[model samples]
Target: MNVEFINPFLVSLVNVISTMATMDLKPGKPQLKNHDIAKGDVSGLIGMVGPKTKGSLSITFEAPLILEIMHKMLGEKPSSINEEITDLVGEITNMVTGGAKNLLSDKGYDFDMATPVVVSGKNHTISHKSKGKKILMPFSHEHGMAFIEICFEDI
Candidate 1:
């Protein structure tokens, strides 16, 4: 994957999360992960396609961290990952992906994104069927940690 494509995701994550969830986010340095699966307790994933590129956008949360974010969004503590909580994860993934897509449009990376899908369980894993590598960007909130992973390939 080209490094030039990275900043859009970082910018979108910080801006969207701050405004929507009212939480401050600190991103750790992004690291390349060449693995078959990404492990997470809860995940929201979106697939993107362009004339020359194909990729997937994924956001995964720690069990408790996702609940905290849902509580903030709902203004009440959420006890479990129900339909509503799962829906919020999809919305967040959409917003993050939309923000990045708009930003990248100027660079001629205009792409179409699939509807986000949410998955939850104990250390569930997501596998990306890409021809390139994955970049894991870990973020820290006052509450806990989560990760945004992008795996893209030239098509």
Candidate 2:
């Protein structure tokens, strides 16, 4: 896979998360996870398909991070992960993926992206069909941790 193809995804992650959560993020070296990634506390999934291959983009975080993010996004403290909070999570991923898509298109790479699907609770995995690469970027806020992972199959 081309390194150029990967950079925009990372850039979009940093930009969206930072803008929405008011936290700074950096492009750390992409690393692979050991086994299948179960949904931690919150997860946002968006599918992408192009001529060469098809895959999905997901961002996952634990409860602390999700709570803080929900608070920041809504400008108030959320008592729990209810429907309102769930809506916010899906919207956040939608914004992040949209940002990435725009950036990627600017660089002449275009594809169709599905609407974000948000899943909560636990014990679920973002299953991939092919042997894929996992790129993890960790972000921190005063309250908690939020990370972005780009998992995609190579064409």
Candidate 3:
């Protein structure tokens, strides 16, 4: 994957979390992921297909971070990962994907996005649409850590 493709998602993640959750995020170095196991407790995955590219984007959040997000966004401190938390993850994924899609579209990379899917478990697995290597971008906030993974290829 071209490194250029990663920027929009990065920007979007920061933007969405900052604007919606009112959280300050510092992104860590991105790395190539070699496995399907998720790095966090819950994840939101979505697929995109375009004329020039096709791939998937996922956002995974640790329990502490997500609970903090829930408190900030909904004014409720959830003790664990529940349906509401999962739904929030899905919505965050959707917002981030939408933001990135707009940025990429401005660069002439228009695509259709699938509905986001939320998965939660101790060590859940993510199946990206593309077979390419996943790029894992980790972010840190005052509460905890989160991750964003992007896997795509020019089709």
Name model 2 segments beyond 4 Å from true: 37-39, 123-125
TM-score-based ranking = 1, 3, 2
| lDDT by residue for model 3 (1-155), tens | 55677888999899988888799889988888877645678999898888877888889888899999889988889899999999999999999999988988887778999999898996566666576778988899878888899987877
Pull out the clashing pairs in model 2: none
All candidates' lDDT scores?
A: 0.83, 0.70, 0.86
Model 2 per-residue lDDT at 133: 70
Which candidate has the top score in lDDT?
A: 3
TM-score of each: 0.92, 0.80, 0.91
Segments in model 1 whose C-alpha atoms lie over 4 Å from true places = 36-38
In what order do the candidates fall by lDDT, top score first? 3, 1, 2
RMSD of model 1 against the true structure: 1.6
Q: lDDT by residue for model 1 over 1-155, one digit each (tens)? A: 56678888987888877787687789888888766355667899999988888899899887677788777666887787778778888988999999989888988887899899999898887777787888888888767778899988888
- The weakest ten consecutive residues by lDDT in model 2 span 122-131
